[model samples]
Target: MTVKMTRLRNGIVIVLLIEFVLALLGYIFISSKTSLVLATYIFIKNIIMLALIFYASSLINENNISVSEVLNDEAKNAFIFGGLGLIKYDKNRNISWTSDLFTEMKINIVGKKLLEWQPLLASLFEDDDIKVVDINSRKFEVYNSKESRMLYLKDVSDYIEISKEFEDQQICVAYITVDNYDESIEQADEQTAASIQSTSRQVILDWAKDNGVVLKRYKSDGYIAVFNERTYRKQVEDKFKILDIFKEQAEQLGQVMTLSIGIGRGSNILRELDELAFSALSLAYSRGGDQATVKSNDEPIRYFGGNSESYEKSNMIRARVIAQTLAGIIKKSDNVLIMGHKQSDFDSFGASIAMYAMCKAYGKKTYIIIDYDSLEEKTKTVATNLCDDERYRGVFISPLRAQELNMSNTLLVIVDNHKPSLAIDSNILDIVSNKVVIDHHRRGEEFVELPLLTYLEPAASSTVELIVELFEYQKEEICVTEREATIMYTGMLIDTNYFRTRVGTRTFQAAAKLKELQANVGEAYKYLEDDYDTTLTKLSITQTAYRYGEGILIAFGKLDKIYSRTLLAKAGNELLGISGVKAVFIVGKTGKEEISISARSTRDINVQLIMEKLGGGGHFSMAACQLEMEDVTRAINLLEEAVNMYLDERKSE
Candidate 1:
């Protein structure tokens, strides 16, 4: 819009100037007469030209307000193209300009009389480093060496005055939450919890009032405050220290507190500010939470933390509600479609099948979206058999087929992963807005908004366990059939390394529930049974693995179609168990598909951060990423460097 307006204004100026010249030349040639006649003709021509210029200028100015207003708010492209200017004003009623790229230009509104205006104009020239090319009683044009174009008279005075109205609009809201409050409270007795809450509230409210702000308690641990820039800046030149004050206050109260802060500005457009604040708070949480941070669109993130412990309780009740909601959605929808990450593994495929069974129990039309031709032979066999069953006839289909059949009423159950980009048939997501995510991985960005339900427990071993827990919560002990229970049990076994890794009370309880449902635990182990050839291949690949850093392991090998991811996880875990090993990483070429990398770590290290550097993230103890790097050696070298850097940073810290 700004570009178009600029072009239109320039075009009109050039056309008018051309017409003025043509008129003058024509008048001179046709009316060469007495002096009075010639003078009158020149006067009329000048007046007409002046009127045209004013009218043209007015038209441009008339559109400038709306154009500037829209560009300020709705111009998403302004970040790439220059955005509209924001007029600013000081407390003393002085006007200024602001933009990320545009410099502030202050113009003095001078003079009660014609002569008095000269001194004000001269002072503006001297102070602003601008030069006045011409000055008249009611108009002036100024030029600056730092920028192009002459400043128009009305823009300097009238526009600047109008911009002052934005001064009082500076009162802002800061949204803050105490991170890990549930865990903190749970760790303490009732009296201690009350004391801590009272202490925190007083500290926050007192600080807010002292800083000339009003603190409004929203939720139990959340607050919104009104702040002015003047008061906020006076409190902290380096505003990051505000978080330190919170930490100090919490320490003095004999407790720990971590704050997630979101600062909002812009009066008329509070929603944008709210979004920015929410995004900032989310980033703070993702970076392990417990800090006060400011997020202005122009400012870089300012984090403050002492690397404190962050352990919030997983929302088990919410997960149960989500499951019940998902069950209802499947019953109502025309079809239930489930998908998982690409290069489906035991957990992914197993979880998908489990969800399919749950939907089937409700007599809903269901399909498991898969890359049939590209999937592993074993998986294809299971999927084919399920489709061949009379009950599941016309249910199983390729991701491409599912995309065509999906509609708004279709219920999508994205399993084993929440990241939209990682899901099979990600594009199909848009067709069905009614969706649920049953994932056990830690939350990451890129989740679909407004999901009908989401059951994500980062602490849970697998989506299969979440499903099992959901059944227990619903008290539907007999809803899952023997076959479905076996599948769910298989997923839990694969994810937990047959109850050897990440096994907890809930894990054993889930297994017991499956057992009660008549699931053949021994038959579930049959799914884990591998042929001697595949076992030998994994063993040989493990023999080739090399140690990197204290705990990380690296190996490159081609394996038979089976035991690629399973072997990778096994190899990584095997390395991690070795003496003095803190973490492990295994990379391999599974099939003609992309290179696969798996990472594992103990409590002493966070392998998730390492993989996040490679555009992947999971639990701190386990993670994986797939890159398009065809050269395996180069990838290994890069991964080694990443591991070394992470280890070195931990040591230094």
Candidate 2:
């Protein structure tokens, strides 16, 4: 109540108190007739005063509710009772019954309450001599003292949510085998090794049996399991610690097991399932082994524990293997077709030519697919010079012609890229059953799988080095034309920025070999030169570069008809020249078809992680993706946030 209203109520009570005091005093001392009249007047006035106080307190207390505020609408509805004073609250008979001189009618407000304290009518009486009664069956309680009158408020609320029902669904099957099991065992004594293997096998069998899963023993070293969702959940939550279990059990056995798990979900198509399972196993091994990974229909790809130490690959062995692989490809396929990523750059195109020359050495019919007019004039001049020669007449074909020549007898050789979607002629991929993917880029999500062979070394500067390594391993004096050698060298120089990035012992060796093959260094350097306008364009765009966390971002407002991915790929490397930047992202306006985004990172950051958020993924260091967004500004904003988030997370860690 307002202070004014409270004051008015206080004034009326005080007046009543004074009148009662005067009348009581007169009744004891004055004449009997006068005293009786005065007592009756005070009694009526006291009754009227009590009624007014009740009206005021009841109205204020009811309007101001504390309990209703605590209870939600759903809870409030459940509290309303019928008007018969027989309010039922479940099976409990805890309600207290009482009676008063006034009617005992019960009221329930079926809405939220906002009262902070309960009101008492006794507080309205100004006279300390006033009395009140609380009547209970078989008992009489009197409120004769003002100190006993008090009110208190408290909040009470609790709720439970309904859970969704679970259905019986098919479960995916996953199996694990330690990659270095044999080596770890061989290091142990005969008795110790035997005991370790036996104990480990028993532990796996017992765990599977207790979970009601069926296990099939494969080669005494690999065990396959079958399970559904209920079983799988138990396995992840319970059996993920199986490695720790094995560690404890085999402590005295003198050996440890490093596990690699492979999982596949679908059952009807065993071939596809087998391929997927193998891929999962490969991924697990790549992750340094020793973990569990679950695969199902929901995940088109596999899952593995990331950040594993990769297996060390020897350069000589890699080169030898690739040479043999190339020879086998020539032996199996009748024709060899080579191509690169779209809007082929000097490196991509040069790598294709190198692969084509290698194929030609095997007396195999080879076709180099390219868009001659789309390249820079220097690149176009070089390609035109090579194509005009009679020896290269049947070798150079347009993308359309390459698409038409698709056949099962042909081998599709994809260089500088592993992503089929970014290929020059993806249709060629669909037509040729046999394929070889040689790339320097890190593996991405949409990389072409099911290849006859694939050599993906992210550490290499360019695919040209891959071809050079293959040629070196062959040890045969295969004649490479001046133009082919220069093209390959130009591509290597472009990707490596003149031996600046990821160029190691092998890169230098390959460069030496290319130079020995009479590659014109001056001509290749000329191919990298750009006009004054293009240089100004690059510099102008770079001025907008800004720091985000440890990374840098820049957007190209204007770019020519050339492919933006190639341009940003160049720009991303350029941005990395700025100090303190571990990663860089370049966004540019391409044609109406797509917005180009290129991301590059040093060892401390993974640009692919940011790109993957936009439905694109690439290697840990350098990656490019096309945003389908029509608005370039919106795409850039989203990319900026992504880059910042990635760097922030890295910093926090």
Candidate 3:
């Protein structure tokens, strides 16, 4: 006999036995109520009922017919009636009893709880609305009753499969581009050039064919592909291994060749999907490329693989163009206000001051918005000096005052940061109609929307470098006070970590311009010197840090005391230079209700992506994040998990 026949035979025997026991119990109860003498016959009555049921079962077993010959799949053709099965359990979810329909359905519920055999049913027991689940290759609609401690399961596989079929056929669009094709191809020889061109094409074509995507190449470096939702889901399940394919191929080519892939789905409109794909691709480039960014209709954009730092652009044309546009916006606005990230450091403060002078050169009323209460000890000195200067009196204002000023045609120039949430006063952004962003950090998903001009150069050492270049293209000449030039030079010094970090040709050129303006190097260095207490904190971090696997170090400060963001960042930077430590993550309490992390890495690691996973972003070498947790130990646990997860993903590739 087949397995189904055995199951059917067992189920029949069990059901007949249950019925026989129940009937004997009813007969025994009636006899006991009649007379004491009849109670003695109760045991005999039960044996007779059992014997009768066994004889009937044996007669059925003697027949030659099997269950397959007796019934169709699901026993649908054999049964004239079908009923929903009822199950009851305690609050602990242990199985107490099940109705007869469960036996007919071939479910092995004997001596088992809901979760023991039906782990998927664990969540459905929450007493929520009716939910659908799959059990034994059949779909079920589950309805729960907490008051009665009962659950109702009805098979609905036919309707569920129809809905699933429709869902799997939804359209998905992907836009792909060779990230460094223009630059890489210009330098390659014939053999290598052919590999970058045709080999790159074959890599994508093969993957697309494997994934059931219709591939079309529109440009030498660009392509468009289409696939269904089922295929797209499988790609996500595999963590978008196309990124790993590109990484392996680039290794063989011995050059910087990578791809940016943007996929858009969850919508039927083809035009909307195309637009989304394009937008996602642009975002991927802004975030330093070498990745796949998937954007769904109403969902957050998901990122995969950005293990490499963005390559620097060699041209200054884009910088000059942005400078001209910025100058025009400055000339048109009635009044301009400059702001930076919270607790503005020398880089942020210097960029804002330079912008202040640039706007002032346009002969427009401009003020640098700052909050004195939040200023660092070093920035307070810079602010005090500017106030004492004859040229800068009444030039600096608070964010509150900037917002209260006449609101018409006002220009907002945010420096050193693009994300509004990171601003000193995010609310100030809402009142200003025209805005400009000057930043050197890699772009993240959050951005200042529809700015009048955005000058973002992640490759540049500092925002001040971009500002100094803009000075060459401006229509008006900006005169430098020795104090202003010193601030600008200090911004460059701080961001580049005193010229130890990445420094390029334009970085030096910008530094040369500052030197010519009589920016005293001695004065710039004075602002970077930390107090004795801060020095102690920075030293403690490295001493306390413990090594994590794969050249990562983890450290945290006392939970009872609050540490400055600058302190944590400086500690991370210093720890990164130590031998055998490729990346350093320093965690500490920044506020009574908040914990913060400062992550720094060498060229071998990408700390920015790690921080982004923890709700923060910055350059590949440096980044930070703030969490709402008060316990430093708990925060360290989360950081370890993120590091392990990132490392594990790379290992898998």
Candidate 4:
């Protein structure tokens, strides 16, 4: 009924009959006394042998390969492929057969599933693609064929090693600078200056030699380090220990000069890598130095260090030039609009009012873009009072009103924040073309692409400090009304946390100038004071604080109620004044699914780095982040993890 059976019946059957007759005749001839019984016995013996041969051939044909072919061709091919092995498995993952190479390797796979013999190979049954696996300390590339239920494996240990070696040898570029070199050197005594220069010169060269980085000093305080991926990877593994080296040297000699490093990787072009390195260096430089920034292709920028106070700059010439430039632009524009960040705080609104006074002095019409319905109680009260005045009936306008205005040749000034997403109404940016950014917060990666003018000085106590400085260089004699001066003073007071942080000589001078303008300090203090119920709530939040590290404090608000962003910040500020406290975090609920964390520090630790781990950023002293889940416990847990990670990174060195 089968093909082999038909072969026997068509031709092989006739041949078998002839052979049987011949064998019977020869036996009869040899016998002395032959009988009919003897011939019948010989026929039966011949037929039995023929049936056995047919059965053997039929079994071999089932697999579509003869036994001789399988034993010869497949074995020869397996040897030629250099450690190639083939396995055939059924739907149940049982190994039905294996090539001769498997037996040569002494791996008994025929009677067992790979799940028992080699679990890694079992993954091949789930997909029809090549994968690498380890077997007996050797690497193999396995190609799976789902249609045939077969797996082909070839040794790939040598190839993988060569690829790794190539990657390790790839080039990386770096830029380094000594932070505060020029300022401190000019102010130091002769002997101290000499020591500073010598220390700066030797420390970096010694590090470069030890780390195998090729260093070339281009300027007195700048160097370019060229190294391979292996050396760069060493820094990543150690968390950039160079930052500690710089910090230690500064502490030993009083911070004459510290270091900032920027690394660029994942580029084939040397010039592009150099540009990326410089870009990364600028981020570290802008963030107050004593840090390292890494900018790799297609990866988000990363920051480390910044554990110390940033050096301050007081450049009057730069301020004078920016003021003159801004005056020219404002006088030429048809009108102007001043905008601050969302959820307007004292500093943000105060800076906007200062800029508004300047625009009015220029004799040009300008409006402050604000969402009045969302304004703080004190700020809204101020706006309402000003609206009642005859001199400022149309000064405060909503973002929607600004959008409806004729915007031709309008100049937009953004105060207190540079990131567009934080703008009072981010949609205003789409309608306005000419823009300028002014802020005192530490720089982040998000920024307006191009602007007519920009001033970002993190050293200043507040943006109001910078605006007050610009007041001196204006061509037209501009005088802010008494109320305007009071509002501007409030901005500076709140941002500096009562002149306790980021204060400089210029900050006091600006405050004195406002005092001369009859700015009421009493009114500014009143704005900072919280209502009775809010004060009690803030105290409760701060009182629940527990210690984190040596000087860090962590606390939370009522889990069932919503608190203002300002409330959490105020609680964090109060906790910073506690005995021996260096940093504070106040966690609270803001929305149904949003949890807010406000962080503050006293220069003993960098809170920005800790908060950045949770996707929020701010100055070294203050920062905040949000978690999108409703679980207050989870928010606190994540904040603790961030704190632990930050301390762990610093502790490693």
Candidate 5:
């Protein structure tokens, strides 16, 4: 039992003993022969004395009251001995009574002022303790009696300070890595490499010194930083300026550089700290690097420093390994089902068809999953031509049929997109245990989890480029037919905008290999040709374009009938031809209910950030988003708002 309860029990026992003794004395003093009047007088006197003793014992048992002040200043003694301050407030929160401690503290609380303090008091009630700054700063354990309009506070300042000091002394571990270090330094001369490495190391060292952090360079391209909670918080608030500094210095040296930073905190166990730091670093790299990711023991992960573009790693050796792995997985499956994102476009169809051809060569049954009802015009035309061929008949099926044919060994290969929500049918993911993902877009939060094999290269122009690389590394002789070659080349053509943007050396090499397989560029051009009505639509959309935010152009177009996404993208490209335009955004509706925006920019701006804010993602120069709104004007307004916010943030930085 508690101390107060034990004292109350002892007091009750003492009171009972006194009462028993008094009753015994009354019985002894008044005999059976005594008169009724004498016995009644004795009984009354004993009862009065017993009541006085019980009251004195109750005073001694009271937790907040003292025995010495039973008759002298009960309230004053309670406050002094218990080390508590009492404040009573009326309905309006005006102080009705203040104890001696409350008065000495000189708290200037008025009617509404007490309401201002309610949040702190409520937090204390919920947490059992809170820190407050009044006439003097102190930590308190609070007890509140709402019915009596009273509050009690007990001092705990010393204990709170000691706990805080221990927390501030705990160490946080951080791992820093320079992304694509080998690719960046391999081509440089010895002196140039040394200079770049020195500058990068100096920047990190200077930042660590400024923030009171300990740094050690244990590897040529990596560092380990140790700091306390205060320094970590300051680095988070500053958005890890070392990222921007390193990028700036590398650019001056005629090289592109990016850093991935991972911080592990809120754990005292050394093994767990190491694991958290490694997890954070992996997340940063998976998100395309050039960012800082923090993981704490009890909190959700936090992100920063992703405003810049990610440097691409053109690792052919990694690609070859991935290709071989994919072949092995495909051979082991019972059947293969190739799928892509919603509203299938040329890139999606091309990658699916290429996979189909490879599976056919391996003598494995395969089907391409597409939503025929939602195909764009050009993609629909290509699908029609492939279906007309007798050899390619029944190769294309809908998501429903694919599910019906799904088995335990069925392999699902997702191409051109990684987000589960953007899948043709997200339910397919649950049915298939063996899965593979291949895409060229920058990674986002929504991605497939735990695939058998994943080949994602944001540097490639299109998924077709990656697939072509796979075909090159295949061990057996594989003949990519003329039609398959044409389809794959067309996908590359569309994504690279007729070889005008996002084309790398590998992109050209893939195109050359496709030509060697007799891919007809002339036929591909014919497939991309626009009719008279579509040409007039593009002209009208371009005419509606207006300049926004220092040479960024925005256009709003409404279609009487649902048009192809390719046409919408073509309209956006038209606006970029203007001499002064640095970026272009085109908003339109694909059907009765769906609204979409296509974003494009030059090297001066980053359009991916703007689209990501609207719940979509892509490369730095090209991105798109589909919204639920029906009104075209509202979509345009939201687009402008995102653009302005992005520009304003850049300016502030």
Candidate 6:
């Protein structure tokens, strides 16, 4: 209610009380006749006063004018006693009557529109107390009176500043570890190893000092750092430059060094912070290291500094341990079911068959799950050849048949892909209690949550190479059949682009072992040969290729015929063979609703990262993704945009 209306109502009540008191005094002191006359006069006065109050209320309601304005200073004392400040505003929200307190505060509100006070109003609405500066600055508890169109503010800045300071002092914890420390030191002489370790420690300490973080080395290769919320935000804003600094220092020592950093923040409990840090650390390592990962109590994982190539670790000992473990798992199970990603390629099919052969050697019944409808031509050809042989009858089964045969003791092994959504039969994974994942792709956001065992090596050329290593370490003497050797050889051949890209010492070793087993290279080549029509189609597609960004080529068009993934990959690889082309991206439709992209690079660009942005992943040099987009042009545009964005980011780095 307006101050004027409230005061008018109080005045009417006071007048009535005064009338009653006078009537009582007259009746007690005067004669009967004179008292009656005084009473009649009092009744008439009361009626007139009530009529005047009602008329005044109607006028105030119609004009929105406070009674204090109509009778200025009549209720000023009441307003002061109630600790209320009143200011009248015209229809334009221009101030008219400004209180003395506002004037004393040097708040020149009169004759100014309400819009001019938005800054003060915004601050007032955003917090319990707001700082206002006219000629002098102070904080206030703000209140708004809509009926009177007035603002009231009471000072309260000191308390807010103290609360903000306390919030800024919250603690955050981080853990850092030198990835590949063992391999780096083992390859160097004792003196050089000592130098590397010393340099690494000094670099970390210097970084901590520069960032105002308290550091403590808890292990030879691990350190824990504590930071305040303010410093943590600064670190995040800088994108954790310490990771890049460590990489540079390690390279200076003639060693490849990478750090995996995990940070925990936004939690009051130390135990929760520790758990978050551990989770972040695991995520950083799983994404191939050389990065800083942060996980607050409620936020998803955030990453930085993963631009460098992943270092290949020596996995001889680890491979041996895994081989022994897998053998044990296989022996315990009644039957083994092996499958790979949907639309199985050479790498996926070869890895499955290799596992099948290994399980058979242990005298365990094994089934190779094959979805024939989705199989590529080369994979189908291989499957047919293996089925015709007398030794491999009844080895192949459909997804439905596999489900029926699935038992609690059965072991499920996934190869060439780790994402459950991309599995040939994702349902089987849910039904089986025992599951193992083996893939060579860099870990993505979508992956199997918990597997009995995981053999993920992003540095390896292909999943088949890892399987070949396992074969060498298996306790039982297993003979590699010619078919088995050929398929494995073919897998290596395709994934490495005929050993021209992503070829490492271990990759060559796996190939040499396969050759030693008399794997027929000519047969593998025969399966990869394209028909005349396919060759022409690839050539036509190649003609559509155009330079995109720096050293990047993009070939985009709809296919004249539905070409298999093998042919598309060949097209991309052929584009990379052109001089001055560092990378090639081929985008086209293989089916009505499926658009496939085959990315190839020549050690200059990381195509895997590009494909990963588009929901696919593979080796740094070779990667591919399939989108549900039906428009070939739209898919091409998205691919080009992704490639350009990657190139720009690298340039900035």
Report lDDT (CA) for all predictions: 0.66, 0.65, 0.82, 0.83, 0.79, 0.82
Q: What's the TM-score of each model vs. the native? A: 0.62, 0.59, 0.81, 0.84, 0.82, 0.79
Q: Which 10-residue span in candidate 5 carries the lowest summed lDDT?
A: 126-135
- Model 6, 1-653: lDDT tens per residue? 58876896988768796886789688877859878888878878877887787777777676654654645754555544443455566766777777665665567878877657645564543553434433245444556565666666544456667877887799988999998888888889999999988999999999888889999999999999888988888877776778888888898888889899988988999998988888888877766788888889677667776765667777588788899999999999999999998989889999998898789889999998999888877888888878988767988889999989848699999999988888999998888889989888877778776789988887788899989889988878777788889988999998888888777789989999999888999998887888898898889888889888668888864554555666778889999988899999888888878889999988678887899889888767888899997788888888878887787666655
Clashing pairs in 2: 64-115, 65-113, 65-114, 65-115, 66-114, 66-115, 68-112, 68-113, 69-113
Instruction: List candidate 4 segments past 4 Å from native.
Output: 1-83, 90-128
Model 5 regions lying over 4 Å from their true place: 1-86, 93-102, 110-146, 150-171, 216-218, 265-273, 296-301, 559-564, 591-593
The backbone clash count of each candidate, in order, is 2, 9, 0, 0, 0, 1
**Alpha-carbon RMSD to native, per candidate:** 15.6, 19.4, 13.6, 8.7, 6.2, 7.7
Q: Write the per-residue lDDT of candidate 2 for residues 279-392, one digit (tens) a residue.
A: 676555533355455545565653323222222233366668778877877768888888887777777888888887778778788888887756645667777888888778
Task: Evaluate residue 344 in candidate 3 and report its C-alpha lDDT on the 0 to 100 scale.
Answer: 87
Error of model 6, residue 558, in angstroms: 3.2
Top candidate on lDDT is 4
Q: How big is the RMSD of model 6?
A: 7.7
Q: Give per-residue lDDT, candidate 6, residue 5.
A: 62
Q: Residues 1-653, candidate 1, lDDT per residue (tens digit)?
A: 35776677667667766665665666677765554465566557766876876687777677887878887885644632432233233333233433332332333432123224334444443566543323232222343322322222322444444555455436656788886566567777988888778877777887787777878888999988777756656544554455666767777756667677766554446677777667666656654555555566556554433233334344466667776777677778987888887767667887887777677777777888888755554555555666666766776678888878847578888998888788777788777788887887755556766787767665577777777777654433236667667767877887776775566567777788878888788877876676887677767767777766545567666432323565677677666667776667788765455566788766566776678667777766778877665666776777887877666554543
TM-score, structure 1 vs. true: 0.62
> Candidate 5: how large is its RMSD?
6.2
Can you write out model 5's per-residue Cα lDDT over 467-506, one digit (the tens) per residue?
8888887776676789888988999998888887778889
Candidate with better TM-score, 5 vs 6: 5
Off by over 4 Å in 2: 1-276, 283-294, 302-312, 373-378, 406-408, 558-564, 644-653
The superposed Cα distance between candidate 1 and the true structure at residue 561, in angstroms, equals 13
Candidate 3 collision pairs: none
Q: For candidate 2, what is the total of clashing residue pairs?
A: 9
Q: Rank the candidates by TM-score, best first.
A: 4, 5, 3, 6, 1, 2
Write down the worst ten-residue block by lDDT for model 3: 74-83
Give the top-scoring candidate (TM-score): 4
